[model samples]
Target: MKSVTILLYDGFSNMVLSCLLEPLRAVRDQSQSALHWHIVTPHDGPARSSSGLNIAPDLACKDVIKSDLLMVVSGYGYRQHAKPENLRPLRLLTRQAASIVAADTGSWLLASAGLLDDQTATIHWGVISDFTEEFPKVRPSYERFVKHPRISTCGGASTALELMLAMISEQFGPADAFIASTMFLHDAAQQQSTGRGPNRLEGKGTAQLRQIVNRMVETIETPLSLEELAQQSGLTRRTLDRLFQAELAMSPGRYYQLMRLTHARELSTSTDYDLREIALRCGYADASALGKAFRKAFGHPIRKSRGSRPH
Candidate 1:
């Protein structure tokens, strides 16, 4: 059986841990004896997560080398907890493992050990800049997740699950991945096909409405006005507005504006761009306008929101 070791510690995100494990469990349940998982920690003790959930590790870090895959799961205090002392052993373990994956902030641990030196890596979008600043040797991509030569890094909880699903697809087949999605109650077609993460086009609407949402997402960095959006959709302004409200429970203009803000938030946290640059890229006239909208929507200023260290 293929063995996967998930590294856990204090302040780990329980949701991310679940996302990575569920698909793998599905793989095992479907294929019978195809895969197995083991949870590891610095010490075999109760590891507390940032969300106040604690998990017991099955083994210590020193014993993690026996696994076929090693995935380090991390959260807010990762840098402090996932330090050189703790990572060196895991880094050594990497030599014997089939693949090493980092869930969310755990990418930092991999980068810290020089594992991502020449590999494409990603982490939680909120900490991307700090990660880049700290590890200039690594290439940072805007993808939700990226799998390199021997390393895989994911952006957030959602992408963490995608990485797992992609792994299942690679190991078993596309069919297995699709089956796992159905068991997980996710859109299998959307999960594997759409490059965008899930829920980007979630609304009970017609095909034309889905196309309109797609177009809006495409133009997120350089948003179109309501009139232009409707024109592109081959619908009148009044009709488009009515459809958006009826289907999405929001006006077209509001949806478009929120799309821009979402793009701005992702860009702000995932890239080295400043507020001004992000604003320009997200179709805002200036930083101040973007800041106002961002604060109003997220209940925090754009500057403060970047590099979210988890509550």
Candidate 2:
């Protein structure tokens, strides 16, 4: 039997936890190998998710027994939850467990406990810059998930599943992992092949449209005009507009503006960059110009949008 212990904290993401657990459960159901899991919290009692759903812990932090693997699951308000005392138990677990994994912002907690020092890891992409700035010793990666010796980290829900599937492959075999993936309707090959591009528009439009979208993403700091985009796509301005309308139901200019606004929103929320810096990165003249565009596109102030997210 392979024993796994999951450490849960207040305001942890239930979705992320489910993604990591379901595949393993499937493996246990389908294979002869026994997979056992227990959920634990820092203190004895229940832990509530950000959505207010409470999960009763199987054990308290102090009573947690050694396991084959220990994974910390966390999400919003991680900075506030990652207190010194909360991290002490994790530091102890690092020495006890054969393998350690951090899911989502759980990397922040592990990094705080100094377990990720000199190890490559990743967090959710939305906070990659903030994580990198905060944890200089831990090498932050752009990959969806990173596996190191005795330690691993994953970005978000889907990536968590990917990490678990890969672990299943390592533990049992590729056939067992494939069976588990099939149970979840997950296409492992497609998931492995997909890159972290701007968006998923590869099969939605013509080759020319894909080229134009790729160009827009690559040149967010210096966006091209419609004429330039069309020229690069080997189409005239009118033809580009028609193609976009036919494929995406939006004009080329609107699509371009939406793309820039999306990137700006990501920067505003993920990075510590000021408004002027974000504007320049999104190819606006100044903060004022970016604010107007953002409001027109998203129907809310950038500051308000950023503020809505948990710190």
Candidate 3:
């Protein structure tokens, strides 16, 4: 039996740990194998999770000698809860594991322990930039899950399940993975084998528009006109205009311009770029033109009060 230990801290997110463990339980039940797992806390007392749920651990961190896999889970208020003293044992345990996994901001713990150097990893998308700025040597990946043989890291929540399912598929078979998926009902309902899954929007012709919108966001530093966007997307200008009006309740040109202005404001306040350069990069002829548009749209100058970072 392979042993798995989940390192739990005061602010750990229970959902991530559950997502990681539940599938393994399902797999174990189907195979009737002794897949051992133990929840380890810094101490013997119950640890509080982000959702205000308190969990009692099976063991203390100091008692964990060796494990095949160690999953570290973290959440909001993690910085306040995570102490080097409490994590020191897990840091040592990481070296002995067949693989180390971090869910959500758990990467912070790994990075702090100096375990992620030169390895590709990822965290929740919301904290990507901050994590990058803090850990320069670690190559940050945008995938929901990134595994380099020994170290497996994921963004958050469902991505943890995705990582497990992918790993299970490799160890077992795609059919068994699909069975696991059916039990979880996550990607399961992609087939009828899993009962009625959650209702998902079929996108109703909005999928293509969403793809185009994503491209516009990426090209914010080099804004494109509606006609140019339509040409690039291989859609007629009229079709693009109608799609925007129906889905976004705005003209294509208006939506595109707003996206550019939004990115310009983000760059101005968060980055050290100059106003004129920001304007030119956003496709404005001059800084004044960009400022006027910015004020008209947001009722404030680009360099005025700092804007809340996008979530």
Task: Residues 33-72, candidate 3: write the lDDT tens digits.
Answer: 5678998775668879878899898977767788888888
Give the candidate order by descending lDDT: 2, 1, 3
Error of model 2, residue 114, in angstroms: 0.8
User: Candidate 1, TM-score vs. the true structure?
Assistant: 0.60
Per model, how many backbone clashes are there?
0, 0, 0
Q: Give the Cα error of residue 57 in candidate 2, in Å.
A: 0.6
* TM-scores of all candidate predictions against the true structure: 0.60, 0.59, 0.60
lDDT of 2 by residue, 114-144 (tens): 8788889999998889999999998999998
For candidate 1, the C-alpha RMSD (Å) to the true structure equals: 18.4
The TM-score between candidate 3 and the true structure equals: 0.60
lDDT of 2: 0.77
